[model samples]
Target: EAAVTQSPRNKVAVTGGKVTLSCNQTNNHNNMYWYRQDTGHGLRLIHYSYGAGSTEKGDIPDGYKASRPSQENFSLILELATPSQTSVYFCASGGLDRGTGGAQDTQYFGPGTRLLVL
Candidate 1:
């Protein structure tokens, strides 16, 4: 029953500025993730959280950051946005953690927030 929602379906920003993408879930899932989908990069994990009050760096944590203040909210933060970072960002939430021996996770992806850095 995890339903993920993202804010600002589209965004335009200047280089070196900051961009903040928001996400909210209603299923009380313990895991949340942020990913970027680009032309050739496919889906790249940017950051994730195991649960409320905890944020973990994901595979590509170089230009991104994440925060999970509660069980229903997770936010992705771009300290300094760049054109190279222009891409569609997605937020997901699930109850299971595959790496933790939990059942196969059913990640619910958001509609995606398209970011354009100029």
Candidate 2:
């Protein structure tokens, strides 16, 4: 299983400001994902990466940017933070299943980062 971690477990941002969330994985997983968890609503996809130097937009990519400079690191950037963006962010790492040679449905998740926008 991959070990995932996120920085600044808690944060307070102002509207129209910038906020950056960072994630790192110990295991060399080919896929990495960013998700946000909110009240009344479940988790929503923000962005994802297939491998180093590759990033893809997920279901909710607006007002956010993703960067995957290396296999072990991925970052989520909010150029203009908003109150609606206040939520708990999670990072997950997943790869193929050796047994089936198929994508692994089980992903290892980070502790999560909580952001409160003012």
Highest-scoring model, TM-score? 2
Q: Each candidate's TM vs. the true structure?
A: 0.90, 0.92
Tens-digit lDDT track of model 2 for 62-91: 999999999999999999999999999999
- The C-alpha local distance difference test score for the whole of candidate 2 amounts to 0.93
- Give the Å error, residue 109, model 1: 0.8
Model 2 — TM-score against the truth?
0.92
lDDT of each: 0.89, 0.93
Candidate 1: tens digits of C-alpha lDDT, residues 1-118: 4578999999999999989999999877888999999888899989999999999988899988888889999999999998999999999988765556556377888899999999
Q: In model 2, what are the clashing residue pairs, if there are any? A: none
